[model samples]
Target: MDNLGMVFGLTGAAIAALFAGIGSAVGVGIAGQAAAGATSEKPDLFGKVLVLQLLPGTQGIYGLLIAFITLSRIGIMGGQAPTTVQGLLYLAACLPMGFVGLGSGIHQGKASVAAINLVSKKEDQFGKAMIFPAMVETYAILALLISILSIFGIK
Candidate 1:
């Protein structure tokens, strides 16, 4: 009970890394499958498929960034340990990145998969096809900004 604050902070950091990482892994896997399928039929689209597959990978980076920030702030990486309230605050801060990363990552992967299919079918539509997956990244970016701001804003 007494260690609740630190526990919360630690858990938040863990979630930032774990959930986001899982999301990226799943997303990449999904995109990779589509990419492979597309490439098998149209080998020339390898570059396009690769780009689409990597779009979801950004969420993992965002999650990792949030995790690093949380850990650093919580004094796990260094510095003084936060109080119970501060720890809980860290947890709250991490939530945006964790949840958003997970959702956006998976959705982006789906978007990428569709994009890959489009590219496979119409090589000239690559520009428009890339936009769909890129749009999904907007939410992940917003979440990342919120988490970073929250972490730094916390005293």
Candidate 2:
């Protein structure tokens, strides 16, 4: 690929990573606020709320991992650049994590908040409450897998 193609590929990957980070930030922020509110009322639920808050962070880690892998494939990590179409494709593979992770994280946060409320009131059903939002995280994992496979498969 040409220099411009590599640039575009890198840009896409950076943007994807940024979006994923932002998604995680937003998701964690929302969940944290709600969790704090809940904790104030029920100090005993701190551990559960903390777990829920952390769940959203997984997407950001996935994005960062994909970006690093993509960069590695292009030799970007070692201060070199992609010089082939396949290398460009590897960089482009970083896009899915951002799009999927962003929305999924937010939705997951909302669900988790609802779940937290349910669990807080009915301690016996904590598992049931946690499951709904955790399930939403499955999409983020799928996106990460696709991005990783695409980057590796391309080159």
Candidate 3:
């Protein structure tokens, strides 16, 4: 029972890393399929498509960062363990990043697929195409910011 707080904190860290990683994997897989098809037709577009395919991956990194921070904060990485209330607070703080990363990564992937198609058809529009998927990244960034702020704010 004394270690319950540590368990909760660890769960929070796992949730942050796991959900975001799953989202990124799915997003990258979807975008990779589209990118492969596009590049098959025009190898020169590889660079452009690759960039779009990787855009959704940022959320996973953000999630990982949150997890690391949470772990460190709670002393899982090496310090005093948190109380149950503090552990719960950490869990709550991680939620935004987990949920938002999941949704945004998937949507961003779809957006990247569309952008890939657009670029495949009109190579000159690469700049404009990049914007579509990049827009989805905003929510993930916002969630990351909130998670970071919340975690650090927790005493």
Candidate 4:
């Protein structure tokens, strides 16, 4: 039973890292394709496109933070195993960041692709174009805040 609690805690941590990494990979890959295509034609837009491509990557970092916090809280990093209920709470705590990061990262990637195309076509519209993807980042940030708060709130 005690071992099972640790298992649940570890599982939550792994899920946080795994799902978030997948999301970031998908998002970065999608955005990178668009960035490459845009930069090929308008090499001067490299900096702007590169930034857009990197936007989705932040979700992965957020996920990693959640995982680290979960591990520390659960004693996985070097402490006593959590009780079953505590372990379950930790698992629940990781859910928001993992799920939201996945969704937001992919959506942000799509937004970045659109922004990249817009900037490629209208260089002067770069500021406005950046707004779309930047907007997507707000959701990821929100999820991160919620996940962090949840983890911290768990005694």
Estimate TM-scores for all models.
0.96, 0.90, 0.98, 0.95
Give the distance in Å from residue 155's predicted Cα in candidate 3 to where it truly belongs. 0.9
How far in Å is the alpha carbon of 118 misplaced in model 2? 1.1
lDDT against the true structure, each candidate? 0.89, 0.79, 0.91, 0.86
Window of ten residues with lowest summed lDDT in model 2: 78-87
Model 1 lDDT tens row, 18-91: 77888888899999999999989988889889999999999899899899888876777865578899888999
Could you give the C-alpha RMSD of every candidate to the true structure, in order shown? Answer: 1.1, 2.0, 0.7, 1.1
Tens digits of per-residue lDDT for model 4 on 59-152? 8998999899888877778666888987888788788788888898899889999989898888989889888988988888887898788878
Expressed as tens digits, the lDDT of each residue in 75-116 for candidate 2 is 566445666565567656877897888888788888877877
Error of 1 at 137 (Å): 0.5
Model 2 residue 153 distance off true place after TM-score fit, in angstroms: 1.2
lDDT-based ranking, best first?
3, 1, 4, 2
- In angstroms, how far off is 21's CA in candidate 3? 0.9
Candidate 2: residue 29 lDDT (0-100):
84
- In Å, residue 45's CA in model 2 sits off its true spot by 0.6
How high is the lDDT of residue 108 in model 2?
A: 83
Model 2 clashing residue pairs (backbone):
1-84
Number of clashing pairs, model 2? 1
